[model samples]
Target chain A: MSSTLTVADVERIAALAQLELTAEEKQLFTKQLADILDYAEQLQAVDTSGVPATAHVLGEPVERDDAERPSLAIDEAVGNAPDPASAPGLFRVPRVIG
Target chain B: MLQSTASAIREDVASGRVSAVEVCRAFLDRTTAVNAALNAFNLVTSERALAQAAEIDRRRAAGQTLGVLAGVPVAIKDNLCVRGMTTTASSRILEHFVPPYDATVVARLAAADAVVIGKTNCDEFAMGSSNENSAFGPVRNPWAQDRTPGGSSGGSAAAVAARCAPLALGSDTGGSIRQPAGFCGVVGLKPTYGRVSRYGLLAFASSLDQIGPFTHTVRDAALALSAIAGADPSDATASREAVPDFAASLTGDIKGLRIGVPRAFVADGVDAGVRAAFDAAIGTLRGSGAQLVDIELPHARYAIPVYYLVATAEASSNLARYDGVRYGYRSARDKDQNLKQMYSRTRDEGFGAEVKRRIMLGTYVLSAGYYDAYYLKAQQVRTLVRQDYQQAFEKVDVIAMPTSPIPPFRLGERTGDPLQMYLADVFTVSANLAGLPAISVPCGFSEGHLPVGLQLTGRMFDEATLLRAADAYERETDWHAQAPAI
Candidate 1:
């Protein structure tokens, strides 16, 4: 019931997650990743029959009114940005899709 | 006066015996002294706590009324957001992230005038049974430095157990709060799902994640629950039912209560010390006039599997929001790549190893062709697990079991073996799946001097009954009073 997660698998996952893992991180993660997956596999053996799958336990569909409300000032939201001048109203990041 | 419970703190402020500022300073000082060893808190908001305390004092001086938990210092799990405070979820991904708003529980606690002392550490993204997954570092067991404080709410439990704060809030997806509480020898309750609002608490398993409290005593736990429990406008899934006064039912009276013992699930594979302590706890309850009956939950064996499928699937979806475009960490590389590459690179850089592992497994399970066999089948089994609890509750008022199978193991003992670590949560996972209210209260200490908790689970939304039983048990034994030697 145990499986080893390889470095390639880790790299693929990092790609999927939009992360840039260093080579050392990938190596360290290979062992740690395998251990976690092995642990999660323990759930495979439990018998669940007739038990209703609950997406949410509260069961009650809590909906809020879709009314518009005053929003946070744009400056306030971006005020804490490490570099506010890079982008006028949004967080500036490195160029993408070149 | 500073040692009083949240209820007493409110009363004292009202009666003018102590000022809110005085209470805040006392807890702040204690938190400072022990935080170095426990690593329980990621940040201590002394200035903010003092400011809030001063406001409470102003209201008291002006003869204005205060909420039930007025001026009580409470620590919140880092996963739960607080306005203008860092909500890291103990992961490197959100290491510099500061939430702009408060979680539903945080907002409610603030409304009640509860002074938030700081944010406590947890397993990264509430993923692990032990706190070792935290990127910041493992939170040491307050009771024993070498052993772990159970997680993902280890910091919260340790904070409460070490007397740093009388009360703390923690999230339990799969026994995060309860397991850590057990390891640290404190009272931790996981309310029925939706009993507390989940508006701003970081989602782990959207279905199972619940925020509850850790406290020194059962009564304290009840008071904290009352303050945080109730429906909220922000969380659409919040229960519409009125929250009862949990502290009002603290008079230990379970005269004809049918306490069910799940012979198949709880009794098997339990450590000898845990079993002895559990049996002794049952004997004490029996002596107290509570009837203990054997109940079989045939689907109990499948709880772990169903929990993982459902939890991981939902976690995969929920964690998808952590793209670098919106918030948190973004990869410095992959700039020239398309949106897909940007997303992949950001998430890979942001999330810790455990989080990435789960996302991958979830994606694989829910992928095309495998969905029906793995994800769909697991969902069907989840229904069965829920049914078992429903049927069991029809016959019993509450169920009793050992909170964890063994005492807190060494920090790195199970790190190398993931399955062994997941097995640690076996006894505590079913309650979350069933959306039942459960608590882990210190029952006894192991030979190695670690705390053992007796887990009491009750029917959905039946937290009062669980509290009553735990209060009665605490009355007879002084186990909850035993602190870690450190």
Candidate 2:
């Protein structure tokens, strides 16, 4: 009994994602998007009782030693940059804010 | 020679019958030939492969002891960072990004002397059941050109299926590895969460994502698992237990083993052909002296919802690093704008459509007003889903089901129906929910010549039993030997 996703929903999602979609893509994604949502919504009916909610299945937190190990050289890390200009240490991005 | 398993390759390398360079070149040549059509690889590390292969040859000449997997060629899913290699996760955002360090799995594989062939394609950020979500493009199923290779490990599965690589590494969260393996008719395993470290893997759903192996045969998959799975200082969550030699369990005997069939979960919406093949596989196991039991996992019905909510919420948080401030695509025209525009334009131009959709949906579910209604409820339901499996495990040694509801569908068949694509993961997602180890092995073929996978889900940390059952089944069946007619 799930309904299809509307074009408006797709547009809203695109806006949230900051993606600019073409008209054709929007049309195609409407049906596709609806189907995905409907399928995901199928989990709405299960009953969970007396069970502890798990955040990490392995039941352990990700931890690494705080010790500093030899790391990649800064030059080597950014050496492959497509374009390097004023920024000598990192990959440079165009200035967006005035 | 191309059809030889990783074990054989190791033996050949040790014996000097084949040098690592020869093996690497053969695989590279084959990959190059099929890659154009299959799109299985995102990057080809021919130079790297040759260099590693030569190093192995030098070690052999110097009479140095070789690692168990010496000179074996393996492909890594792009999501797992390999230092100096572009680990794009099949997203345009990181299209040119190279990792500064190798993931734990990659380092392990290299330690075993396995030559890293290249990076394979995946669904963007390991989201979506179909590889179509990859900004690079969908990987074509090697079985049928027009059909999709299941994802987000679609390329890893396809690479093995097409014989491009004998073994490949993939990450499974909500069936990414198993589902794609099912579609491509290869062997894929998702070990118990924490069995493998997640140190270098680009986080999808951290709780669910586990790096696993895809191979032509179950034992090879087991070998890869043994090599890569263990405690790591880099991943605090990694299990502290000593890594077991999974290859030692591949005796191909499951006598007196109990295998459960969840009639309630697997029977619904299963394609007739898939069901027939799965049943026949059960019959084969029964004939091999294993006991088959009917078990019910009532909470499985909620897995999809719980998985989506949790996975998306985590994805929303993990992917927030791509704000055009760090590594990833940035907007060229948005320079000198406000911080908000920088983030908005950068993400807009960087991420693929599917990724954006998930982020929005995830953010909505985790929003202040909707958290309890969506995210919190999903977590509660996840507990129920986990309990269902726990209860089922109390009654059986392992659970058996169809790896996928159906065989590979036509490439574009469900491209327009995201719901249908998501449903394709229904059979494989439960194990991820329970943090269980599971594997997909080729069982039989449909009339159309496409392969069907028989899935075996084991109890938490009971990968030995799962591999035993799968190896036993594989010994009795020829499904794993049947490759695509490429």
Can you write out model 2's per-residue Cα lDDT over A49-90, one digit (the tens) per residue? Answer: 465667766654656668988876877666655445466776
lDDT of 1 by residue, A1-98 (tens): 22655788767665654456779877876776566545545555554444445565554486778899777678767655533456567876555546
What is candidate 1's lDDT per residue for B1-486, written digit by digit as tens? 434566677788778899989999998998898889889999999999999999999998998988888888899999998888988899877888887778988888888888999999989999988899998999999888888999999999998887777789999999999999999999999999888998898998888889999987899888888888887878777888789999899888778888999987876788888888889998888888899889988877877777777788888888988776646766667436666666677777677777876776676567666576567777776677777888988888999999999999999998876667877888899899888899999999888878999999998888889999999999999998776655
Give iRMSD, candidate 1: 3.5
User: Which lDDT tens digits does candidate 2 get at residues B1-486?
Assistant: 799999999999999999999999999999999999999999999997999999999999999989989999999999999998998999888998988889999999999999999999999999978798999999999999888888899999999999988999999999999988988999999999889999999998888889999998888988999999898987887998677899998787888898888887886888888999999999999999999999988878777777777888888888888876557776666446666676677787788877876776676567666676667778888877787788888888989999988888887787655556776788888788788999999988876877889999998888988999999999998989998988
Cα lDDT computed for each candidate against the true fold: 0.83, 0.85
What docking class should model 1 receive?
acceptable
